[model samples]
Target: MRKNLLANVLDTPSEPRTDYARRGASRSMRMSIDEMAENAKRMIDGEVIVSLDPSLIDASFVSDRLTDDEVEFAQLKAAIEAHGQATPILVRPIENGRYMVVFGHRRLRAARELGRPVKAVVRQLEEIAHILAQGQENTARANLSFIEKALFAQKLLAMGQSKATIKSALTLDDTLLSRMLSVVETIPPPVLEAIGAARTVGRDRWEELKKLLAHPAKAALAAEVIQSDVFLSKEGAERFTHLCAQVKSGRRAARKPAEPERWSGEGIQARFRKSGKTFSLSLSSADAGEFGAYLAAQLGQLYDAFKKEKAR
Candidate 1:
């Protein structure tokens, strides 16, 4: 039988005693930094595994993972019921004699629902260290999809974690981290949530979707697609594909572009239209037309000013 485990708190620095002499006083202070580093390493290593009643541990305040689907949760619960929880979650003690989870939220939920004790490793962790362990563990497990990881990166940034810290926590290089952040930041959060995690979708597809969504009217259409019954019927990856296809088709339909909008004020009239990279404006009516001619004659000066304004 596995024995019940107990937590051992790491030692903290103590005040230097005068009887020991002044020579050793600075030695303890110098060890402080090294000691802190060691403690953090121990926290990540999960040095102690203890069992706690599920009710005593609170879920992480900001979960790093998306909500598990009912079918997935049921499968996990069944496996744990049969084999017992094979993995121990990591947690930190919090106020009111409770603990906050650092990772393994799905296991925690299963244990809670089953009314069983959850095996966990209790560690004293700074917030950054906790998140770093949490992210790295998930990455190693290979359970999070690409977009899920992107959203996690976005959440870490929102919580004010430095870019360096986030890169370290996710075990990503600068370029990959930049791509993840860009994808998450470009896609609207609600739309992402609605589509769920696109397990089969990768970074490049999402980038393409972002570019397609830049159309001024595509946002409202994308929002409607997620809410439609058709969208909900499909699996996560399918849902993402469906929305992208619809939006891209919508862009094609808009390619013809509409005629110029006409405006009239004070007996002066103008027509404005944009085609590809070019814009055209046609002026008419008695007063404004002649003013338009005079303005046209100064095109050289106007073009110079426009170029200077763009530089500024």
Candidate 2:
């Protein structure tokens, strides 16, 4: 049974971490570097497990999850009550003989609620290794949403970690790491905290929100929606959807339509219309094609002149 449980935790195939294990374990363990690293990997891989007082354990310095899922926590507590904890959490010794969790926060929470000692593996990891281990474990689980990962990356950056370290920790490429940072930087922290984890919301939807919030008017609307009773009543992804809808609706309501005007000159007829920031020019007549081609060709110069004027 213990073997089966360990198999469940380590069953997911991951890249061999012999090098990382060696570096992380060399300081504290008395064994040879190679042996210590192997044992460290095995311990994290669930070869050894021990029960620790949940009350004696503290949270990691940085948090990856934005909010608690009460329903899921209840379900997890029930499962542990029935079959016992299948996997052990990872922790490192801190001052006063207390320990700090590296990952499996939900499991620890469940164990605490059940009034039972939590199953955990103790290791001696420096702060960098601790962050990497926590992030990689969650990444392997594939449970965190895009926004959650983005926020996690944001927090790591605020801690002065390098982009490469953040990428390695979260398993992100350069492009993805850039986008995640952009998302968190663009969206206000209060808005993100209010929306919670948004587990169902994905990258594209978040990008859309970022674009909308770029507009000052839409951003204001979002701020209002997040504060309102209706939006506050919603949860998780629903909050994100509600805020998006309110911002869009506010934009539509705020748009002002101008009267269309017609012009006929030099054997060409044209109509000009304006709505909010969008403007349109329609050309008609036999020479319209020639005139339109001319306009398209000069658009770059025209835009440059407009920018100069706006700057003035």
Candidate 3:
């Protein structure tokens, strides 16, 4: 069944070429010979482009994007209004003559807002094929952020899809698939939704957040921060940054400063303080400067010895 679905997605017909000649009276509306040939090829391949009422189309079963960019959507609506839709969206038929979008969600949305028929290529696809087509199209476009892809993978997993199938759909390797799953699993859903497709936030930043949120207290703090009016007012990237900062600051404020350990031998005294992956050492003696320099110089050798001891 998976093989058949894979083949179906791979062998699906391409979007039909728009008929520029019939678009308008402007010179830009003239179809070049190349475009005409492309349209002829599409016809030969038995591809049909149809206009559907935007009201009849529904979103995909699993959403890939966290939130819509209203500014971008408005721009898309304007473009379609001024120049008409340049390319048709891909959709699969559902019950009662309704359709579910496979890709081209923005185009469908633009058409809907403009109160016009959406140009689309309808294909009959099973669940797996529908997911593959949608994932691959967005992956190719490179518009989805790392977190959005992770959320999509999470949704696919929730649907009982295998990791192999999810990886294939998103063109992700095993390591990346694991990382994506880990991130989604570690972060609270409400926080992720509130962040809303931090378009500028990449994997490293997300991983950092994941580690921070792994602690239940920090995760709870993040949830509270995201609900604040200050956090809500910020945009995508800002929201992510604000959440991270709030969580980190809360963790720091809640932690008590570690007491310093003091050691005295002969005329030398030493103090050491440790706090969450950072440590400080202070020495006071006649040879303190010389001893500190010696220790610094021996760090490499000491680290090697530490590793050897740890292995045992």
Best by lDDT: 3
TM-score of 3: 0.66
Candidate 1 residue spans exceeding 4 A from truth: 1-46, 251-312
lDDT of 1 by residue, 1-312 (tens): 123222222244556568555557567766887888877787677666678998988877666666577788899999999999999998998989899998888899999999999999998888988888888998888478888888888888998989998888788999999998888777788888987877778888988888877666887778777777677778888999889988877632223356898998887888999887998898888777678889899999999999999999
Off by over 4 Å in 3: 1-46, 251-312
lDDT of each residue in 57-164, candidate 3, tens digit only: 999999998888888888888889999999999888999999999999999988987889999988888999999989999999848999999999999999999988
* Count: clashes, candidate 1: 0
Better of 2 and 3 by lDDT: 3
Sequence-dependent TM-score of model 1: 0.65
Per-prediction tally of clashes:
0, 0, 0
The positional error of residue 233 in candidate 2, measured at the CA in angstroms, is 2.2
lDDT score, residue 227, model 2? 76
Q: lDDT order of candidates, best first?
A: 3, 2, 1
- Extract clashing residue pairs from model 2: none
